[model samples]
Target: MIEIRGLTKSFHKHKVLDQIDLTIRKGDIVAVIGSSGAGKSTLLRSINLLEVPDAGTIRLDQLQVDFARKTKADVLELRKSTAMVFQQFNLFRQKTALENVMEGLIVVRKVPKEEARKIAARHLAGVGLSDRMHHYPKQLSGGQQQRVGIARALAMQPKILLFDEPTSALDPELVGEVLDTIRKAAEAGNTMLLVSHEMSFVRKVATRVLFLDQGVIVEDGTPEEVFSRPKSERTKQFLANYYRDQEPEFTI
Candidate 1:
């Protein structure tokens, strides 16, 4: 389980997150939705200690994050428990898909190279990239590269997975394939915290949804509740523009 309390973060003099509190149970798929600059991505990164919270407590299972006394070792351990996947596929150019996935296990976890290869192959297959294991990032399409990224995270066996706009960088036609891979991961009961603009995907997979505006959570509820009958005016306006292009008219 992941628990966060009194989370706050700032950049220079500008506040990006303000006294945020949330709890995510194991195997829950929680989606954070908002307009640009709403601090959704910052909040996800903060959970993994990628962005230090100015004041907050983050606990993942037995591990605790002390933002006040955050050390390099603390950050490393937190990162191991929480793997992050970005919008841009950040695969090493020189490494093959399999090698890319195996890198963390071999380097960080100190697994034997052979054992890491086996694990990497299994994760790649899980993401439907087994056939492309030998391909380099440059040789694969955008969606395939993102699949390798997913495999790399899975190879770490993280307790929590954080996705920051995973499909934002993909072509429209390729977005479905990447989201489909994530849907499978969700079905497998991984604890996921996703920052995404894909409302349909959120509606389909999120056990809970958070709507943020101006660095604070304005709405928090089950996906059905938030999407169908939002309580806050901020949330209603946000969804109004968000579902503007969709058919059937988003309504309660």
Candidate 2:
């Protein structure tokens, strides 16, 4: 289980996160949904220390870090338990898909080079990128590169996988493939926390959903509850606009 307590953050004197308390049970696929500037990305990033919290305590199983007093070693230890996939497909342009996935394993984890290769290959294949393993990021489609990013994170076997708008950078036609890859990962029982605008996908795969407004999680419940019976007015307004253009799975 992952426990986060009293998490808070500010940017240039503007608070981006309030004192947030969240608990994620194992195998929970939690999806955070909110309008832009609702602090969705910040919340996900803070978990892996990508955006350090002003005050918080995060415990991932046996590992714990108090942001107020955490050292570099504590930061690294916390990071070791989680892996993040960014929206922009942050792969190395100079490396092949396989190499990008193997870099962390062989360098950070100190796995043998041959062993890293095998592991990377398996994950790349898992994301349906086996044929593109040797292709560089520039050579692959946006969706393919994102899959490589996913594969790299999967190769870490971290206790939790963090996704920050993983499909936002993709073209509309390419979104489904990346979402499919994530669904497959979920089926494999990888605990995940994601910030996404894909309402339909979130409703379909998320075991739990959070609605954030003004840096606070105002609603948290099963997908059915949040989408169909949201208790917060802000959540209702947000989903109304979101589903206005499509066939809504959510009742505004």
User: Cα-based RMSD of the predictions, in order?
Assistant: 2.4, 2.6
TM-score of each: 0.96, 0.97
Q: In each prediction, how many residue pairs overlap at the backbone (N, C-alpha, C within less than 3 A)?
A: 0, 0
Give the whole-model CA lDDT for all candidates, comma-separated: 0.92, 0.95
Which candidate achieves the best TM-score against the true structure? 2
Give the per-residue lDDT digits (tens) of candidate 2, residues 1-252: 999999999999889999999999999999999989989999999998889999999998888899999999988888888999999999999999999999999988999999999999999999998899989999999999999999999999999999999999999999999999999999999999989999999999999999988889999999999999999888899988877878756787
- Candidate 2 residue pairs in backbone clash: none
lDDT, candidate 1, 52-86, per-residue tens:
88998888888887788878988898998989888
- Model 1 scores worst on lDDT over the 10 consecutive residues at 242-251
- Report the Cα lDDT for residue 65, model 2: 90
The number of the candidate with the highest lDDT is: 2
